[model samples]
Target: MKKSLVILITILLSAVIYGCSSSSEAENADNNTEDKPTLTLGQTNWTSTIVPTQIVKQILEDMGYNVEVQDAELGAVYTGLSTADVDIFMDSWSPQQDQYMEEYSDSIERISASYEDAGAGMVVPEYMEDINDVGDLKGREDIVNNEILAISEADPAMEDLQDIIDAYDLDMEMVNSSEGAMLAAAEAKIEEQEPVVLYGWEPHSMFQQLDLKILTNEKVPEIYGDTSIHVTVQNGLQEKAPEAYNFLSNWSISIDDMTEMITKIDDGQNSEDVAQTWIENNQDEIDNMKSN
Candidate 1:
């Protein structure tokens, strides 16, 4: 009977020890998960936006973060950031996006300028020497088939283009299309050395692939103000992911480097691979970004 009692106590103690060990292991796993919070980054499909977002994504993942990328239109991207449905947005064109910023000012924070010399407006091939200004397109509707190739109508730049058309009384139609389609159209036109009017911005590979010029418009300086690309985030991102926030706050890339990475991406290279190559070559810059 004493032996039986001893055996029973041994079994109970063994069971208790096993249970405590399992519970401790489970708690450790939960703590590890809590320590590495999943970060969701908002991205637009534009190549300029994709390159930097992917670079930042890889950097954060290297820092032991579980990163999620959500691609959406500009409006939806902004809305997601504002509501904290998304944590970071790498590309926010200022002044042009000022209205959205104003609307979501209370929820979104502009982290830093990614690049400062970005320009957006009507662009024409250099061959079209006469088409140097928005007003220049007024009489050359036939050359462009009475069309102004542009991106989605949801874009604020599209609205600005419409206003420019009405303001200049250009007999041109704003043909709405995707960025890919617009660039394809512009490419086809450029190959033939033909004249085409399309929306253009810096930090894009097109400027490197083709000889193009951004047309000026004196009538709407406000719309075409000195454009600067910014990195924006949800209001709580700084406190929620301080490491990621610090990396982004110190992030800035040259127009030349961004354009080169964009060209690589446009040429069928994987964006992450392109980013990795850039990161490898730019360790000093990357280190600076993470210093604080």
Candidate 2:
């Protein structure tokens, strides 16, 4: 009897100790997970960046991460990424933005291509049937005459674009305005079938909402060539948030997809609703990009 009682007591004690250890380990794990650092993202006024930024924010939150976004200027975004004030910047246009990148290349790193072939160029409503290319614009200047080429607020890339205009000695006026203002002007002009030329790029609401054509510029060199945009992150972001970085590195959306999103937003659909709709509809794309 004494022997049986001692064996039973020993087994009970061992089980209690084991259960405590397992419980302690689980508690520690929960605590460690709760301690993970929050991620910070930076966004500019560009819709191309804005839409993706929101998508990324949603994904990070789903991954149990704390994410914050700051609306900043182009220069400020680059500086923030370089200095690690921001963890990631979803909109970095290359070659055109080469000057800014070169200045901070040492501190900032290019994570991946967000959306390639995005940049500023002249675009006309599809109704302007004769103006098919950049060369054609010179002949039909009157139709597009006094029609200012709207541009986003002062950005270094805009400066490079202006240089191209000067080099080509193009007679059109480049109107300096906010992205919102430019879009509003473009919208009004398109509504009336009035001819206008404006700085345009992909992943924009205008592209989806309007039937337009991008005027081809032959004078632009091929190497510096086709315009493209990239996704850039702070120098230590990968090491800091490997999961978020991986999602961003693989994340990409087509001009058509972005255009549709922008169009929905412009047409009075709430941005959050539009974003949720996109996320739910494109689960496969998001899953492939976000998978380990």
Each model's total of backbone clashes: 0, 1
- Candidate 2 ranges beyond 4 A from true positions: 1-30, 139-142, 221-224
Candidate lDDT scores, in order, read 0.88, 0.77
* Clash list (residue pairs), candidate 2: 222-225
- Residue 281 lDDT in candidate 1: 97
Q: What's model 2's lDDT at 181?
A: 84
**Highest lDDT against the true fold, candidate:** 1
lDDT of 2 by residue, 188-212 (tens): 8889999988877766767657777
RMSD of 1: 4.6
lDDT digits (tens) for residues 1-292 of candidate 1: 9999999999999999999999999999888667977899898899989999999888888888899999899999999998899999988997778889999999998988988968888898888887787877777688889988899999887887788888888888888999999989989988988889998888788877888889989877777678998999999988888888888899898888999999999989999999999989998889988996
